[model samples]
Target: MAKRIVLFMFMTFTSLVLSGCLVAESKYLKKAEEADALGREAATLQEMHRELSAENGTLKAQLSRVKEEAAVLAKEKEKLSADNRELDQVLRSKTDSLSQTVADLRQKVSDLEDENARLKEEIAAAQKAREENVRQVSKTYEDLLDSMKGEIAQGQVTISELKGKLTVNMVDAILFDSGEAEVKQGGMDVLAKMVDILKGVQDKMIRIEGHTDNVRIIGNLARRFPTNWELSAARAINVARYLQSRGIDPAVLAAVANSEYRPVATNDTGEGRAKNRRIEIVLVPRDAP
Candidate 1:
């Protein structure tokens, strides 16, 4: 009996020890399961952190690219502003030039208009003076024609008006003897009458033109008057001096000698020679120059 009881106690002790070991084993298994679950959760959190870090890097790169593009846009905007200012300045300069050109053109037009007005006034004044001169000359011619009617009818003098010139032609026989430069009594009377009529005309210039027939001077007359030219010149000068002595202004008198060159008719006949030997009084306008 004692041996059996010892064996039973030993068995009971072994069983109790075994039960404690089994319980400890079960707790260890539960702790290991919890640790495994924690490990899985940590791995999941690490994966999420890596994804977030990569997303942050992508966002940083996008921000860098955006900053670069913004810098380029700012530079372009500044350049465009500068170009606009330059263009505005150019436009203003051109506008100023155009305004000046227009002003100059206006001044030129004004000057031309003034010049045109002055020219028109000058033309009108000139025309008026010319008309007055024409009327005065015409009246003088008609008065001369009437005054010398008797001499004209006798063929001793001829009065003619042409192109504003008045000419009184007197035959040499009525004024002087043959081959003589001195005036006869009849010539003196004719010259005195002409002087009386001519004294009234202050505006016209009087010219005495002496003409000679184509006859050579001879004898004592040749000594007094060498050639026809000398005889004609002496005759014209004497006539002009007589006119001056008879109240005619010397300023209005001119003496000319035409020797045998100017002839009114053929000098081959005696009657034609008589016609060619004559004294001519010419009335010319004062403004003939």
Candidate 2:
């Protein structure tokens, strides 16, 4: 446009010069120069406008790309926020479960400790009671041993103590004669001394056990006694009856018969057979069944 305006102005000035208009030539030349200057200024302004338009277009494109990148960054930020919230919830639930488990374990450990303490106390009390019982039993054994020293020396009686019980073993010959179950005079004398000692015992049950040799019964003895079982039972009953008549408590007495099965020695020799035929008097706790 500036070039076209400049060309039209130059053609008008050339026509004026050809028509011989010398008075207007100076004015036309000045107008022509002014028009040329205006044309050059317009061309410069147009070039600046073109450059400004190009720069504006580039800026618009750069702004559009920046907007797209901002949208992507916003979406990523939202996603990361949601993920963080989920992670926090999971961590809280796990912590709560773990705390409950730890509390339950601590309660169980406390209950076990209480049970262990109770058991320890019971064990200590029982140990103390047993010690007292042992001391009492030892004293009783010493007294009986001293009282029966003479009979023990003559081999007519044997005394022993075990656990919390006292035992007095007597040969059957001194109490009976040739399968007889009745107590002899000498046996009564011996029993009188033992009964005196046993009567003083408290909380003790006196048990009389009758034992016999392995000899089988025959002839006159068989007719009266039958087997050793009946003989031993009869002997034990007679002894218990005798003790009851001599101031010993009938309620505390128990008579048991052993028919050669519970022998102290082998029954193959005379001395062994003699030893096998005996009576055992045991004193035990009244509560023992």
Evaluate all candidate structures by whole-model CA lDDT and list the values in order: 0.87, 0.88
- How many backbone clashes does every candidate have? 0, 0
Query: For candidate 2, lDDT tens digit of each residue in 59-142?
Result: 999999999999999999999999989989988998898899889889988998998899899889878866766676677677
lDDT of 1 by residue, 1-289 (tens): 9999999999999999999999999999999999999999999999999999999999999999999999999999999999999999998999999899999999999999999999999989978866775676676667776777788889999988787788899998888898887888889888876776788765789999999999888898888888899988888888898888888899999999998999999989999999999999998877775
Q: List ranges where model 1 is wrong by over 4 Å.
A: 1-112, 287-289
Prediction RMSDs, each to the true structure: 8.0, 9.6
Clashes of 2: 0
The segments of candidate 2 whose C-alpha lies over 4 angstroms from its true place after superposition are 1-121, 286-289
Per-residue error (Å), model 1, residue 246? 0.9
TM-score for every candidate vs. truth?
0.62, 0.62
